[model samples]
Target: MKLDIIDLNLSYGSTKVLNGLNMQAKPEITALIGPNATGKSTLLKCVAGILKPTGHILLDGEEILDKRNKELREMISYLPQEIPDLTTLTVMEVVLLGRVNSLSWKVSEEEIDQAYGVLEDLGLDDLAPRPMTELSGGQQQMIYVAQSLVRNPSLLLMDEPTNNLDMQKQLEMFELIKGVTAEKEITTLMVLHDINLASRYADQIVVLRDGKVFCSGPAEEVINEDIIQEVYGVKSTVHFHQDGFPQIVPLCSVRCLPWQKRKDQGLAHQGSVDFGQQN
Candidate 1:
């Protein structure tokens, strides 16, 4: 699936979140990166049809804004940032719920096989009978990822899919996502905070700043010291690996300098920083 967002706008009461946001996502991983509260998650929700925003969202040249929620849900699988309370549900049950749109009163053998197949692919088949509440946070996060994949969606939207995962697990999860996306030809839009990880895995990176697209391109062109300073207000060194992916080493925030120096440079009030806080 190819997704195109044109002049997208969203607001909450008096504050505007997304303003004339426009981007094109193809059948590959497109990582959205920005500072906190820059409408990264908000854009995901709008695309997922959870929040109605005034804009033109086209899926493969067709408008989806007028589509009903059920229609949209059937076409797109969205994994939200907040994990739901799966207190009594088993892993298999939760995963099967991903097919709720097609499930009958009695689940067919095909649905069961599909659910189990996704769990096995994710290496979570052993946890099928385990209660969700008993699993660790990382385990639960992977299970939700499986739930999103079980639907065989053409378009996948994931918000912070690596949350609560350890270093090794984070790598494993992204590997799975990249592999599945390519094999299935799914258009994936993921919100990620780790710029290096995004650069390494994503085919394209879209940087959001102040509710608009600051820059959009491959990691080689998009991940730079200038973009880091402007979008994140941080001073960083960008190093390129042999494969040409950029790795960011953040030194400090622009506001982390001495007060007098900041004043002299006239950057004291651009962003706040705590002297006692450690990066």
Candidate 2:
């Protein structure tokens, strides 16, 4: 499936968060990368249909704006950033909420099995009986993620899915996401702070900055130092690791060249400033 967003705009009262933003995400993991306050989360909200855009969104040649809530919920599953205060519910019960749109007044065997199955895949089976408050940070995150995956929606949109997780758990979450998306042939889009994770997992990358799209293309095209510097105001070396994905190495401020460091250090040098040894 393909998602085509055309000339989208979003405003927060008086402030404009997104301005004429547009991009397409195909049937693969597409990553949204940008610095803080760049509308990354706002863009995800618009894509997930949580926010009404100024323009239209076409999914597989059909307009999403005309669809009802239940109809929209049938096709897209969204994992929002702010996981609510669900301290009272058990993990299993929370996962069942994702299936609500698919459920009737009575529960079905398939829905129960599907909810349990996804919880297990997300490595939350052991914690199923425990209340959400009893789980650790990573476990809570996994449980929330499981809730999103339970419905098996055709399109999955996530905002900062890997935030506040340990390295091991982050890898585990990535593996589960990769396996499920591949097995179900689902189209997944997510916003991520870690460039390495996005590069390694996402087939496409979109760069957003200051309510506008700096660039939108494959990770290889948009993850370079220039784009990073332009959007993030930082000098970075994007390392292609093992032809799998790109990892970002942010250089130290003292290590940047004269032209690069001048922007931060307020130096007025014209030519290059060699920070290397004078040999």
Candidate achieving the largest TM-score: 1
lDDT of each residue in 91-150, candidate 1, tens digit only? 888898898843345777998899899888777899999999899989999999999998
lDDT tens digits by residue: candidate 2, 1-279: 789888889899999999988888878888888888889999888877778879878899899977887888889999989987777888877888888842345667898798889877766677878888888877888887888888887899998898678898898888888888888888899999898888888888888887877888777777888777767778778778888566789974334575676778887677768898897
Alpha carbon deviation, residue 131, candidate 2 (Å): 1.4
Tell me the spans in candidate 1 whose CA falls farther than 4 Å from its real position. Answer: 101-104, 256-279
lDDT of 2 at 58: 88
* Candidate 2 ranges beyond 4 A from true positions: 101-105, 253-279
TM-score of each: 0.90, 0.86
* CA lDDT, candidate 2, residue 279: 70
Worst 10 residues of 1 by lDDT: 99-108
